[model samples]
Target: MEKVTISAAAREGIGVKGALSKIRAEKKIPAVIYGGQKEPVSVTVSVKDLDKIVKAGKNTLVEMDLNGAKELALVKEIQYHAVTDNPIHADFQRVSMKDKMDVVVPLKLEGTPADVANYGAIIEHILREIEVRALVSAIPHEIVLDITPMTINKGLVAGDIKLPEGVELITDAEAPVVHLAIPKEEEAPAPAPAADAAAAQPESSSTKGKKDEEGNLTKDAAKK
Candidate 1:
């Protein structure tokens, strides 16, 4: 598990439209922290700073410093602007050190399958992520699928991967992660049209202006 630290400020007058608008204009995002058996708190954090943390993935663990009071949380949700696609609001769920939680971990394919290029094959990723339960400290940064030993027409499923100790798979073992593909054989070219006797005549550049010993064109040359 990767732990991170971010700072935030307890927001004042957040419910007011005027105050929320001002925060967005300043490039800050309004967020709420709930759970951990405490009343939800409204806070504001830098849009630029929090954006970096979320890019690490939703399962990332964060320790927020809200004006000296610390809280452990998972970024539960992020609302993005429909047009600009920028982060507008965020929701955090407070968690405890002892909690065994389910989080979605990203799946990464690690190697090239054997004979992929020679066979004109492709690797199609089916399940790009999986949910797992573990203590906050036991979550893996990613789920890795090693395909070096996989050959064309082969596949891997959730059962194929061995995870870090203390992590339990919540996804189905039979669910496929990736599979190698072989492209279909192309249809044979239509038999070339039967040769056209006239069209197959010798190239003109090679036979142009030929004449006989009498200085008269030969019968084949005269036909040009």
Candidate 2:
């Protein structure tokens, strides 16, 4: 895990309706740092810096320099603008190196399963992220899984994942992670216009000369 240092300044007028808007207009994001048994502190950080932290992936360890009072923290949560999809607010949780914390990390699959080419198999990635408990220094940025050995009708469960030393899996071990399935064969189309045309036709020349038992001229004969 890479530790990144970011600069932040104290924020005032938190409850003021437009205080956050004004901070955003200046290319700064409002944030709060809480937990680790200390009072939460409201602060503002550069939008550019916050974006870097986000791009680093979930549970990124960051050294927050709040006016020279350094604190080890993790990027806990972020709120984004619905319209622009830009981050508007962020939450940082204070942490200690000795404490074990549970955090969700992304899963990355590597290599193509051989069944995909051999039998036109489809790979389904059921779980994209997994929760783990570990010290801040032991947590990984992402978990990489090698799927090259998977075969058709085969699947991998959460227990199959390999965790780093000191990291404990918090997600259910029985949860499915990925599966390889064979593609279903498409059914042939039914023969169109299935009704028999001969049976559906009205009486034709074959029946024109025939008369009924009543001895009255048949409708076709009368027309003739």
Candidate 3:
């Protein structure tokens, strides 16, 4: 995992009402750094710097420059504008190199499954991310699982993913992350039954038997 230095400055207040609005107007994101067994500090970071760190992955370790003071932190949460999709606020949780933390790592699938090309089986990616426990500096940004050798109906489970040295898998071992599923044959719907088909059609007009002042079969059995 690569660590990035994030420049930050101390804020004036604990972000009371209207304080964040002012910070956002200046194109700055209001953030708070808490934990690491220290007093929480109100801070602000530029939106550009924040996006770069976030794009790298939240699991990325941040070297904070709090108006010149230093601290190591983890991005805990970020609130975004629903309409504009811009960062509104963020929270950074301080962490130490010695502390083991559990964090979610995005799952990346590598190589196409053999069944997909050979048998036209579909690959169902179930779990896109998983949790792992490791030291602050040891956390990985993503987990890559290879499916090149997978066959039809075969899958890679959570345990199949190999973690970096000194990292521990916190996700369940039996949970399936990705799998190959056989495609269902598109069978034409069954033909309608014969009797039902007949009922569906119009009935033929009834024949009027020949009659001499009477409706009855006559004259050589209706000329059989």
Candidate 4:
């Protein structure tokens, strides 16, 4: 498991709101450390440093140096500015190295399924991450599943995934994460009706069989 090192100072003389705004102006993130039977502490960290940890895309282990007191923690939640997409605040859960904690980890799919390659089936990913419980140090960065032998109608559910030693899945075992199936194509629309059919055809017999008074009819009169 990779750990992120963050430097924080024990905040003083300011409320959370005031500190948070100041942190944001400095391009830092305001965070709170709670849990494990200690008084919650408010702190601030550089946005650049926090971004590196968040890019891992999961609840990651954090090594925080708070006013020279080091602690192990996990990122519990993050708040972002609705308009600017900047980090507004974050929460960290203090943890003991010996205790187990529930965390969500990313899922990585390996190898193209046989069905997708040989049978022209489509591979669908239903879930890209899952929750699990494990000791703080034993947490895995990602859970990888190989789909090399998968064929049409074959799938891997949460239960089918293999875990590293000491890690246990917390998600429903029957929940499907990946599957192979035939692709569905959209059907083309029917052709439109012709303009004649839509507007009604002209009356067909209106001029037929008319005659002139020469009595050979107009046809013989015109021959003269």
lDDT of 3 by residue, 53-117 (tens): 98887598889998778999889999999999999989999999989998998998899976788
lDDT of 4 by residue, 1-224 (tens): 77888898766646545765666788877788999899899888888878988986476788999988997889888898899888888899999989998888889999997667676898888999999999998998888888897777668899999999999989999999999889788899989866774236433353234445532335543444
Model 3 poorest 10 in a row by lDDT: 202-211
TM-score-best of 1 and 3: 3
- Each prediction's Cα lDDT score? 0.85, 0.90, 0.85, 0.82
The positional error of residue 1 in candidate 2, measured at the CA in angstroms, is 2.0
Which number leads on TM-score? 2
By the TM-score metric, which is better: model 1 or model 4? 1
Answer with 2 or 3, whichever has the higher TM-score. 2
**True lDDT of residue 124, candidate 1:** 87
The regions of model 1 sitting more than 4 angstroms off are 55-57, 188-224
Per-candidate TM equals 0.79, 0.88, 0.85, 0.78
Please give the lDDT score for candidate 4. 0.82
Order of models, best TM-score first: 2, 3, 1, 4
TM-score result, candidate 3: 0.85
RMSD of each: 7.4, 4.3, 4.7, 5.4
